[model samples]
Target: MMTLSNLTSPFPIFHFIGIPGLEAVHVWISIPFCCLYAIALSGNSMILFVIITEQSLHEPMYYFLSMLSATDLGLIISTMSTTLVVLWFNLREISLDGCIVQMFFLHGFTVIETGILVAMAFDRYVAICDPLRYNTILTNARILQIIFVILLRMIVLLVPTLLLLKRLSFCKTNILSHSYCYHPDVLKLACSDTKPNSFWGLTGLILTSGIDIPCIIISYIMIIRSVLSIASRTEQHKAFSTCVSHIAAVAIFYIPLVSLSLVHRFGQSSPKLVQTMMANIYLILPPVLNPVIYSLKTKQLRGALLKLLLSKNLPMSS
Candidate 1:
């Protein structure tokens, strides 16, 4: 007697592809990956530590930056956990539950980061366009509320998507592109009706990026209007300089994301390596570069970092 479980292995295990065709050089690939992960972990951790310890860094702007760093850390840990294991050790098999867990965190963190960036854009809008009301508007209580709402939004949209996934039986090929468990990658392997899963996935994406991208754009437009209204060029430059880091952050985060989506949607014939590497970039680049960007671009963070580093060395030198 043949059973469905016997044929498909209910809760089928999935396998990972290490760079598609370049399987032999996963060792070389992991070298830079390990380096990037090290920098991302240490850098974001340092940013959070500095922000927490230094009383001067407790303002609303730095608080938002701390949230960004924390999101980046979650993203890095979620995706990189499987990546390094596959690249360095050649272990590629993952249980269905494990893959689903990875998918949840990866998608959740990505959405959270977008929300945090939008929040930061609003933070800048308040700082520049309504300077007098900045602190009053972005109070500690309000910031906590904002964070809670974002997490709630993530849960509200994502939980049903995962639940829909659980109801589907994955009986197709269990190979996934990239080293991580991506939503679309997992969805296609389901051998059951997936319209509900797809709809929820799209709903989650639209609610996050569809709304967020516009809010960020509108916030900056207002910011630009306020900056140009200033009489002195120096003041205008000063105001614009404050926004450079944020603009850079937005660009780095969005560009790779858009590219990866386009590749998946339109470039179906493209090499798996292209899609795989793009996914890697979308996950890894922001974490590795955001700390460097903030540390170098934000004057107060830079000074605090230098002071902390110098203080540590001073005692050691003696």
Candidate 2:
């Protein structure tokens, strides 16, 4: 018989509970979760495929959309396997290194997505606010440079958090609250002091998501001012219309994120099911909704998608 000590030895394996206090209904719950995952995967994949294949989409804005799709794909991949395993097979055991890897990718992809949103905001800002200089400012080389900088920033900031986590000794229950391994959720399982881990984690959050949100807001503020300054109601409508898809994407991504944070901080007495649901929404909604929003709102993407699909269905000439 395996002893309790053997199960939770220093840096021992960790298990994830799909949703605390809701194991009895995990199968039923997984039905929706699996559907959402499929949607996220298919939608983001279609966006990437269309953007890459359509030469007409070789613009800075579309490039940013590609990056957004890539980031969402990464985010979904980071958690999908582990989450599905837990839900489908109840295989919750995760080694320490595996957990760390999951935490890194999950948080890193999230930060990258946030950075991409900020970049997209800047793309919109330039397109709307400084249309004359848009092409000159967002040259292909410059966009590539911006993506490199965003990725480097995320990696540098996340390393410290991972290092701190690795240093902490886990001697407690070794069970994670959610299906996925998050830095904070993992940190809570450590028996040793996690102040450094917590401090660095919070700092990382501030540096990435925190900074990105304000910069995005500032970009939109400038965009709104520029749009309003246009004398024609028609031009103003056009400008605002261009921003609608981005605004919707931002809202879906941030609202659940903020709600999850609030629930974690203030809803301690709230049911675990509520907290888990919010977290799932935060993880799943944006990836599933963003491409749909873009496809519906952006005429260029819709037209390209229709053309692509129609071409595939048409008979090939010999």
Candidate 3:
């Protein structure tokens, strides 16, 4: 006889999804998730270590790779706290303020990662399209400036939407579709008129991912043109090869993001589990795969990684 209306509190509590209609299997599901979290954490951690310690990886390219790894780590940790506990212990509840904090970093790092990719694209563009300018264009100071702009942009674009959340009323069901706090997921639960939230949210996406994706595409196109102009076929191949890992990184980061957006915007009749899975993929796929992809694709990183592993495993001298 209890209604959702009566259960509403002064401060709302949000519940994260646990595969919807498959609650009985949450414990079993946690196993793979736990393994994934381990891979994400350890893999990114090792990547960071090798990039920092290996003199070979201290170039502009590897510096960007380090930023990519660091951002992936941030993305993983953002969701790990709420998501793992919800699945393992049935602790699905989070207060409004908590949800906002999670959304901030979850989305903040996401934006940072996007910007890093853009910078990486620029790095590649300069290295190939204008080899002489590569050093001057992407100096350590310039990299620092790019990072500062990314952080500043994240704050400029993301903070206002979250700040506005304090003014909304959650009179409806507060259960979010994914195990992490997402902006759209939380925005929909607000009973107050949310046109401003919707507006700024869409505007942020337009300004962030919308602009970044095209810049990457254009960078690649220019890269291809530059490669084709090279007389020796072997050098062209080598130039293209360097871009493979970066291209892969960009694909994994944006594909799920685009697919999730499409599903949410048009797939109203789709199952809740489908949306939940889509959102999970959006968050988990990149962090889980980036380290492996880079390790396998980049010879320098792979070699450094192998050396580090062998050194740690070798027997100590008496």
Candidate 4:
């Protein structure tokens, strides 16, 4: 028995559509979504565990990998409860404050991950371009400094976004088109002018992922040039082999992200289901596949995971 006054009150609550136009099958769709969440959670947790516990992995490269896993975990957990509850139980009501908080963490973690990937590219560049100076270049203190800089950048960029959203008035419909809150999604629902919010959101994106991708490309070009200068083909192969894991990780992360951005920008005419599905893939695929890609591509990580499993199993079996 809700009144129009309550619905349109200054403290209005927002509702999510949870895959608009597909309500009848939401329960069925939750199965695969749940499985993806399970895999992302366990895989990232395993990566963090192996990297932290194995003293052999206490290097700059693995430190970056561990940070990547942690960011992925944050991204996944940020949307987990809201998304699953909407799809599984039709619970779509969320407070305006709650929506803003979710949007903050989701985009914040994404920005941090992009920064980490860029740092990893720098790691690969140093490891290959100047192997002799790699240790001096990426000391433990330097690694910690890079991590602090990433977090600080995200905070400074996102605080304005939150403030802009806070000043907006939401007199129009409070229904969001997706299962979780995103800056763009939430901004579009505001009855007032959202130019400031939109501008900050785009600014944040360009500064983070937009800048990161080009830098990563430049780093790779340098790495390839360095690899080619090696006197022996065996040395060249060894150098390129070290990069395969990082390259795979970059591909899996950026491809879906770029695709989703394109779809959002140009696919307004496309089916709602198509946009929704692409968004889901963009959010879920990276965390689920990153660990698998590393485990398959990096021999040392695979060996460490094997040893960890064996040690645990031996105790239980005994």
Clashes of each: 0, 0, 0, 0
- Model 4 — TM-score against the truth? 0.94
Tens digit of lDDT per residue, candidate 2, span 1-318? 976555456657888878877787878888998889899999999999999999999999999999999999999989999888888889999988898898889889888888889999999999998899999999989998999999899899988888787777776468776788877677777776888877887888789878989998999999989988899999999999999999998899999988877776678788877877788888999999999999999999999999988999999899
Task: Give me the overall lDDT of model 2.
Answer: 0.87
Considering summed lDDT, which 10 consecutive residues are worst modelled in model 4? 3-12
Model 3 steric clash pairs: none
Stretches > 4 Å off in candidate 2:
1-8
- lDDT for each candidate structure: 0.91, 0.87, 0.91, 0.88
Q: Cα RMSD (Å) per model?
A: 1.8, 2.6, 2.0, 2.8
TM-score preference between candidates 2 and 3, better one? 3
List TM-scores for all candidates, in order.
0.96, 0.94, 0.96, 0.94
- Cα error of candidate 2 at position 225, Å: 1.1
* lDDT digits (tens) for residues 33-129 of candidate 1: 9999999999999999999999999999999999999999999999887999999999999988898789889989988999999999999999999
Which runs of model 3 end up more than 4 angstroms from their true locations? 1-9
Task: Locate the minimum summed-lDDT window of 10 residues in model 3.
Answer: 2-11
Residue pairs with colliding backbones in model 4 are none
- Choose 3 or 4, whichever is better by TM-score: 3
Query: Predictions ranked by lDDT, top down?
Result: 3, 1, 4, 2
